[model samples]
Target: MRILEVEHLSAWYPSGRTRRQVLEDVSFTLDRGQVLGLVGESGCGKTTLARAILGLHRACAGVVRHAFPRPQMVFQDPYGSLNPAHTLLWTLEEPLRAIGTGRKERRDRAMELLDRVGLGPEYAGRYPQELSGGQRQRAAIAAAVIARPALVVADEPVSALDVTVQRQILDLLAELKRDDSLSYLFISHDLNVVYQICDRILVMDKGRIVEENDTDTLFAAPKHPFTKKLLEAAE
Candidate 1:
């Protein structure tokens, strides 16, 4: 079943004298438990598409329909996205408070999520700056999932990390998908990483989906020139 559908999506940036169209006529449907990798070069509207899916940016013209609850994001920069002043507990609590989940429930849920992400209860009191890159990334993931979101928008989730940490986080994401049946819209420029986790791939260029196919098929028989260029770049 299709969990999310984006139809004829478009977005414009207001900075230019004539509003520049950053995304144009983007469309795709994602199935439940499926990971769709949005891959392209920089300035190709990859991040813009992610923001639109998460409702952070309004689409110029199109419909983004989700069959399930709203999606959550595991941002690229764990420390930057997280508050430096707040403890991990408080960082997790803000979302719960926003959604009106009770204090006690949020506290219990936060701790449990931390544990699930491979962090101990002791780390709850620590600040974001105190943790390593991987730990901080895991904390960010835990925070995103604490509310039990059905979909996750992971934007360059492991891009800044070392190869080892990236693999660990990718494994964690795979595990979460299996355990919770979560759907993912993972945005990244890295083809190798996309192949590692995504079931299907969507190739975006100039703010549009140029080609899409099952991960293996796309790698083995890419039809689009842009897709071929991307594969060549990866080599």
Candidate 2:
């Protein structure tokens, strides 16, 4: 099933005396349970594409259609994304509470979510500052999935962690994808990381997608010059 479809989508930002286009005629589709990687250098409109898809940015033209309910986002900074003052349980319960879940059910669901993310009930009582980087990220992931969102937009989800921690978080995400049958719009500047987790890759340059292909095909033989440059840089 097609979870998301974007056709001729465009976005622009106002600059000095003129409106500068940040996304131009961008388009793509994401299927249920598929992992689509959006790869590009900084300021290449990668995040703009994500924001537009999530309705965080206003589009200039075209359409973004999705079969799912509102999608969730996992930001780059784990610590910053979470509330510093709230307990982990409280953080996880916010979504459930928003949907009118009862107090007893919310507590039970929060504990279940913690278990699913490989954390224990004890950690739920701790603050964001009390946990390690990996633990905090795990909590963030748990929060993102607690509501069982159909699609998740993870923008550089593991970019701030150490190499070992990065692997752990990536593994956790992959496991969650399988367990939940979730579709992900995984955004990153690192081709290598994307190659490891993404089924397909989209290469963005300036403000457009220069190339896109299955992960194996793109890695073995990149067609576009910009794609080749990204591959070379990754190497």
Candidate 3:
């Protein structure tokens, strides 16, 4: 089933009286359990697309239909995404509270989720400042997935972490895909990382998808000049 569908999506930001378009005519569909990697240069609207899909920003024009069960986002910054004032337990409880889960159920599930993300149950009682970057990112992912949403929008989720932590988070994402049948809208500038976890890829350039192909096909035979440049840059 199509978990999410976006067609002719465009997003713009007002820059000191000028409306600058960041994403132009963007279109894509995500199937259940499918990983569609959005790859491009720094200003290529990868993050903008994520925000548009999540309703964090209004699209200038187009259609974004998320098949019920909604979607959730796993932000890139572990430290920035979380609040230092809130305990890990409180952080985890926020979603449950918003979703109206029972108190006992929320507490019970929080512990289960902590373990699922490879963090100890005890860590839940600590604050975000007490954890490592990787630990915090894992916690973020845990919290995002704890609600069991059908889709996840991961925006540069491992970009700020060390290589080792990046691998760990990638592995966790892979494991989650296998275990839970989760669909992912994975956005990143790193072609190598995208290649590792993505089943399909959409190559963006200047707010447009210049090319797209299955992971292996795109890597093996990049047809577009922009895609070829991306491949060369990666090498």
Best-matching candidate per lDDT: 2
Write model 2 residue lDDT over 1-235, tens digit each, in one string. 9999999999999898899999999999999999999999999998889888999997477899989887999999887988999999999999888888899999998998898888988998899999888899999999998888999999999999999999989999999999999999999998878988999999999999999899999999999999999989988
lDDT (Cα, tens digit) per residue for candidate 1, span 86-159 = 99999887778888999899999898878888888999999998999999999888878777778999999999
lDDT measured at residue 96 in model 3 versus the true structure, 0 to 100: 89
lDDT of each: 0.91, 0.92, 0.90
Judged by lDDT against the true structure, how good is candidate 2? 0.92
Q: Which residue pairs of candidate 1 clash?
A: none
TM-score, candidate 3, is 0.97
Clashing pairs in 3: none
lDDT of 3 by residue, 53-97 (tens): 888897478999999665889888888877899988888888889
Q: Give the least accurate 10-residue stretch of model 1, judged by summed lDDT.
A: 52-61
Q: What range of 10 consecutive residues in model 2 has the weakest lDDT sum? A: 57-66
Which parts of model 2 have CA positions greater than 4 angstroms off? none
**Which candidate, 1 or 3, would have the higher TM-score against the true structure?**
3
